[model samples]
Target: MAVDAARDGVRSRAPARERLRAGGRISRAARYLFFGAVLGYFCIPMAAVLIYSFATRWTANVLPDGYTLDWWQATVSNPRIQSAFSTSMALATLTAFIDIAVVVPAAYWSRVRNARIRHVIEVAAAVPFALPYVVIAFGLMQFSGVVAPQFQGTFVLLVAGHAAIAFPFVYWAVDGAMAAAGIERLSETAEACGASPMQIVRLVVIPNISSGLVTGGLLSFAASFGEFAMAQIIGRGLDTVPLWSAEMIRSYSDTAGSYNRLAVVTLLTFAVLFVLSAVVVYWNRGQTVRLLPGAGASDEGGRR
Candidate 1:
């Protein structure tokens, strides 16, 4: 009986080891291809931007006309560019701040419980994600013009518009993080240790899910920063970066220098968002490492 049992165990071990080795080999090959494609795609446009930012001329040619610092100076010295940047910074800050206040606690409440409420909130959150900006903007115009006439065509309305759109971003990202975090034990442990609900969230939960919050916040910032239609339609003279950039482009296409400067601005916008996104991805990776058994376990654990 001992011999037979030992043989059976050895047989099981052999297949398990074989499967593990095979998977590792397969993953290495797939990783190379997947990472290569991703790196290539992301780097290409930014490379073009960097090239163009320095290029005196950015046209469809075999190669760029070498490089020059004049475009750099043109972009740097423009007062309009400076104003747009300041507006973008201020607007994104307010949007992220407001969204955080609303979304984080709501996500925590919706999660850390029976999941039915979370499911409902998740569905509601999807509404903004799916709705067109045009529709949202129109709705805002309607609401602000009537019930909240004091908000119409003001910073209050603009911030509110940004916050509404940003809510779903923070809510979904943080909610997904909380779901992955093995919520019950953490909440129970915190409660047992004489922690109030608010304290449990402020210190324990938020730190653990910081990555998601940061990611969601950055994405919200980017969305608000790049918002044009809503700002243009709502904030005609208020002039956030995207709106101002659009206005500049619309008004001036005759001058090559102006276009080059605009391209530089575009590059700057893309770079900022790209860097922010990269930071979020890195942070999310860290969160995944902390929570999951291993890198591949997350996809499998969901089914479990």
Candidate 2:
């Protein structure tokens, strides 16, 4: 009877261990499957674009019969494309700078003032993101004639439109960083040391939140660079890369050259944004390492 009882206990323990092992294996399998699906979803479209960019002909065939750089060359040589590309780069940089300048101060002020004010400002910052693009565009157009007639159809308005859309991204990025860094405590410390508001901002606040500032600025720049709807309506017939690409697609010819050219433009935009994103990622890693405990000691040891 004792032997039978012992046997039963052993059997129960064996099944429990096996069940845990099976559950772990299933969990890992599910995680891999989920990630694999996500990876494929993004990579598949990018792979298609890359392949099509070099193809001389794709229609009615599994792959291009020939490959050529003629489309890329043509795109590079086109004066209109050159102008639009430069315009986008310049506008994106300017818009990003403006966003940084505006968002950082506003976020800091709201935090320093009161909770109600901060909430109100946060809602206001999100207005552009929440409102439909059509509504914003129409409102801008409606007021363009009356508010600032001379400003309409100029680069100023284009920058303004881009800035409006990009502000929320900048605001959230910097605001979150401030909160995470415990800006209020840091400010109190600075005040205890007899630092002025300006001194605290320049010496303490900016340095601590530098990572967030870079991230926010770059994100805002990318947003402005790729904005289509606002540029189309608020730009008042501006010749942006997106608008030009749309026109090319609309007036497609029987030949595959047009499609190839469009693909090249698309890839160019992707490459630029990809580089910026990579920079941000690398910078963030460095920031994280620097902020980690005993990071300086590790660095000194490595140097030795």
Candidate 3:
């Protein structure tokens, strides 16, 4: 009777275990399916654009009738496109640097010393998102007219606008980094060691928050590069990439090879962003090793 009862128990438990295994498999399969679908959704359009850029003619076909490098050549050689690309690059780079210089210290100070001022900074950062781009541009234009008339319709105004709008990105990134790094504790420790405020920030704070700085800088750069509405208003005829791309589409929509050129530009932009992302990832890995206690030592031991 005892043996029979034990067999019955074992039989019941086996089915339950089998069902749990099956459910786990189904869950994993579903997750993989969802991930693949999302990947495809984003990648397909870009793949099509890349193909079209090289296509000599692709009308109502599954693939191009032929392929050529004419569009790439034209886009590279065009002086107007070159000028626009350079302008966008310069503006984005400047905005990223300015945001880093301004936001890092402010975020560090807020995190370490006066938490009360953080709310005010948060409100200021959120202002760009709360208001429309058009309104912001108009307001800036009016303000610049009164305060610095010479800055009107110049790259200075564009950079200022870009920096203002991109502020939130840098601020949020640095704030999160500060929190994660336990900036208050770190600052206290450094001070206890007789380090000055500047030394603490330069030596302890910045090194720990390098990942956030890169991330924020990248976001700021991307935002400035892609911004259109404010650039259109404040730029006053400045030929950034967005403005030039708009003009290309509006004026040459029907012209032969115009779309191919646009596709080339799109791919180039994607490449630049991808390279930046790669850099960030590589930098973050090093930062991860440095930030975690004993991680670097463990890695070195494993290597040995």
Candidate 4:
């Protein structure tokens, strides 16, 4: 009688467990379906653009009649495009450098020295997001007009504007990195060891937060590279990539194969951003080793 009753209990629980397993499988399948749908939604358009860039003649057909490298070659070899690309690169590099120089020290000081000032710093950083790019661009234009009219439509103004807008990226990155590194505690320790503020920042803070610096700098570079409104208003004389692409779209609307060249430019921009992102990821992969306790000592011992 006892054995029979035990078998009955086991049979009852087995069906419940089976039902749960089936339900879990259904739920997982649903999640995968949703993910795939979302991925397809975003990826399909980009794939189309990529295909069109290589297509020699794509009409109303399902596929291109043929494929050729003419678009890529023509777009890359165009002197105007080359000039625009170089200008964008130079502006992006300058913006990234300026942001890194300003934000790293400001963030470090706010985190270690004066927590009270952080609110003010955060508000300043948030200004770019709160205001539209057009507003900022016009405001800078007006301000520059008043203080220095000679600076209007100059690369100097463009760099200043880019730096202003890209400031938040570097600030937030460095601030997060400093928090993660526990800069306050590190600073205190260094101070106890009779290290000066500059020494502490140079020796301890910067090294620990190098990942953040690179991430921030790359983000700033990407932002500056794609910026249009400020560049349009304040950099009228300059020919950046975005401006050139816009001109191709607007002025050459009737020109055959114009879109293919534009598509090539778009892909090139994506490639540059991808490379920068990969750099940041590669830089971050080393942070774990650097942050581990006694990592420096371990390295020295291993070397010896």
Best-fitting candidate, scored by TM-score: 4
- The local distance difference test score of model 3 is 0.80
lDDT of each: 0.72, 0.77, 0.80, 0.82
lDDT ranking, high to low: 4, 3, 2, 1
What would you estimate as the lDDT of candidate 2?
0.77
lDDT string, candidate 3, 1-304, tens digits: 5433222221123353463223344455665676699999999999999998899877768998899999999999999999999999999999999999999988887887788778878678667857888899989988998999899889989998999998887776676677779989999999999999999989999998887888778878888888988999889879999887787677665347778888888888788878876776676664533322222234346422
Q: Model 4: clashing residue pairs?
A: none
The model with the greatest lDDT is: 4
Poorest 10 consecutive residues by lDDT, candidate 3: 4-13
Per-residue lDDT tens digits of candidate 4, residues 202-287?
99999998878888888889999999999999999899999988887886553388889989998899889889877866877745
Clashes of each: 0, 0, 0, 0
After superposition of all CA atoms, the RMSD between model 2 and the true structure is 10.1
TM-score of each: 0.75, 0.80, 0.79, 0.82
Question: Where does model 4 exceed 4 Å of error?
Answer: 1-30, 252-255, 281-304
Clashing pairs in 3: none
**Poorest stretch of ten by lDDT in candidate 1:** 4-13
Determine which window of 10 residues in candidate 2 has minimal summed lDDT.
4-13
Measured with C-alpha atoms, the lDDT of residue 172 in candidate 1 is 58
Encode model 1's per-residue lDDT on 1-304: one tens digit a residue: 5433222221123453464223343455665676698999988877776776677655668667677888878778878778878877998899998998887777777666555776676566565667888888888898778897777777778888988877777775676677678656788899999999989988888887777788778878888888887887777568676876676678766346666676688888887888987887787764433222122224345534
